[model samples]
Target: MISLQSGELFDTTIKDLLIPADKVAHVQLGNNLEHALLVLTKTGYTAVPVLDPHFTLHGLISSTHILDSILGLERIEFERLETMKVEEVMNTNIPRLNLNDQVMTGLNLVIDHPFVCVENDEAVFEGIFTRRAVLKQLDRRIKNK
Candidate 1:
């Protein structure tokens, strides 16, 4: 539960909510998943975006995906695994929130999507939102008491 003073709750814009570019953690598509795992573990991030050689957004991968591969119940082949590119893994039908969108709209998408890629209609990767970020914002509001 949250409570705030009248002026305390600033209508948070996406620009205000977005994890700034400097704060975003992302990986290149060519990078090995092993290295990606290392980064994820170090940063405590569940997933990260994969970018192309030209820095174009490709897709996202998560720790769960890696764990599924390692569990081997599916018995994936190395060649087939190699073909399992981030573009193939990431949710292409990404739900995004525009910079002008209301904070609650973004919060609704976050309920289902672990992270939503912030972008224009062209789907450029601007930044991402994690549960941590949202909670952090909420914590700020509570502390404003």
Candidate 2:
């Protein structure tokens, strides 16, 4: 956990708790479902951020999304994974947070999501603010109080 002064707890920002982009596992928009699945499995994450060639936050891709896309009436179409692109199946209507967003703002958003993508003013991918991180901070604040 990132150490914080008791007084600073309520003033915490998303950037303070962010898992920086470089440290996060992600896939590019042009990436195939096969590659996205590999990344999700290797990182032990159900989902990961999707970016364009310039690293702008596009949306999110998940194992569930990949599986759903490849599902067929008769059976799972595993072969389709190699043919489908991430951009074709990613969830574009996702909640996002700015780097300067308050912890309370993140707390609200995380209630419905495991993690929220963070973006800079330029809409460039910064990182993610996770529900676990919010919970940890809340726990620390309670202990201090």
What is the lDDT of every predicted structure here?
Answer: 0.65, 0.91
Runs in model 1 lying further than 4 Å from the true structure: 1-10, 70-84
Instruction: Mark the regions of model 2 whose C-alpha exceeds 4 Å error after superposition.
Output: 1-7, 142-145
* Model 1 global lDDT (CA atoms, 0 to 1): 0.65
How do the predictions measure up, each by TM-score?
0.69, 0.91
Distance (Å) between predicted and true CA of 27, model 1? 1.5
- Give per-residue CA lDDT, model 1, range 63-107, as digits (tens): 776656555556644444444445445544557666666667777
Pairs with steric clashes in candidate 2: none
Model 1 / residue 144 / CA error / Å: 2.9
Best by TM-score: 2
